[model samples]
Target: MNTAPRRPVQLYRALLAAYPREFRGEYGAAMQQLFVDQYRRARTPGERTALWLRTLADTAMAAISEWLKAWRTAPPAARLVRAAGILFIIGGIFVPLAWWLGTLRPSFDYPYRYQPFVQDVLAPALFMAALTAFTGGAICLLLGMWPAANGHQRLALLSSALGSTASIVGWGALGLQLGDSWWSFAMGGLTLFFLGVLWAGLAADARNPLPHAPGAWVLAGLWIPVSALAGAVYEMVTGRWLDGPDWVFGLALMLTSLGMLWVGRGLAQMPVQAARAQDGGDA
Candidate 1:
């Protein structure tokens, strides 16, 4: 009947907020009564400590289960990233399909290298659409990870904003037929965009809640920079997107697409993982 012993019970009652209102409304009183009884029965300090620890563990498990069932209620950041993931996946699909379609065109076929983004009917349409989606998605990925960013949000945002703007403007320049070659204008934007992606990946990796999510982002970011650098090197050596066999470029694209797919999946599962992390005080 000592009042001091009831503090633990009170704390546990407050922690009940972890459960949904409907659950509490239905079983709240009974659960509290049971906890009170259990606390009172713990006459020794060690017993009370044990009970509190056990109760917290049980509550964390229950909270994770219940919260997962309400994943639709995840924070805005989670939803944004989820949507970005889907967009990335869509872009990934479009790029290869566009490449395949472009390969069928006799004029654009480049042996030993992946087909470059080209101006055509369906292929160009798909390629542009894919780039638009990818740029938007990459920006969202950066913004979505903003809240959880340990210290890299500002740099990530600046790079993405500048890069995305450059990319969009570069495309606009081509649309206006301002450039002699698409690559002449496109390379600048593409370079900035690639850098943005690199920083964004690092930012996401900093404090990302989902497993392997950062790795996926990094993989998605790596392809372009590597490809561009290699292409530059190849140009210096022999030019023309590389000499000899061209499987490496093709493989990089394939892996980048896979990386997008992985990032999409990870974002999809992020709501559950984030909720659990927050509940466990790890978020």
Candidate 2:
């Protein structure tokens, strides 16, 4: 047996890239050597497993701590953009989690089967947490995106901003015991948000020319409408006149999540005009 965990070592190397650049420059070689030594010394599979669990936890904490330190020291625009990006990624994580939580309601539909603590407290708490994080992310994104935008990007971002506001109002009204009518607002808001994102993706690509073929934005643009058309086609084939299969919505939701994630990543990595000005010695 080779005993050398090729995949784990590769993943660890990738995770190490998340650390601060200066920190890596100083400690990178030593850290990789230490991990290899520790892994090889573990005589049993269980020991290796325990080592990995500990390593993962420590890596996450240290990476976060290092990033926070960097954030504190970074320029104002960079700080804001990084914060927005992190918030967006967090929101993306929560979207599916929140959706999954909602699905649990039907599982415990009956009062006898349901626990009040879960329905009354846990679910609402989780949902509120998601809402807060996601809304904050959307607002921050608008702030970060506004600076470097051209006319088309500005227009798209304005649409996204409106979508964000509508979503907030919809979610807030629903929270306040408002009627089911608010759901329409919420749905409309999400549609606008997706549209704006797809539009922005195209505009941004035109400006920057993404390295990939056809581009990720194009995939998202194609998928959003295709998902709907696919759903309708399935509905027609299955003779479900009014609706399509559940997976239609699921597939769309998955694409939207991916699209949002990509958008956040791009925005986070984007050049801050202020930072660029400083580099160029322009006041």
Report the C-alpha lDDT of model 1 over 80-176, residue by residue, as the tens digit. 6666766778888987777667656454465433434443566878867777877877677666666565566557655755665566667767867
In angstroms, how far off is 89's CA in candidate 1? Answer: 1.0
Model 1 regions more than 4 Å off? 1-72, 105-119, 181-184, 202-206, 234-247, 272-283
Number of clashes recorded per candidate: 2, 0
TM-score of 2: 0.69
**Residue 193 lDDT in candidate 1:** 64
Clashes of 1: 2
| Worst window of 10 by summed lDDT in candidate 2 | 205-214
- Error in Å for residue 124 of model 1: 0.9
Residue 4, candidate 1: Cα error in Å is: 55
Q: Whose TM-score is greatest here?
A: 2
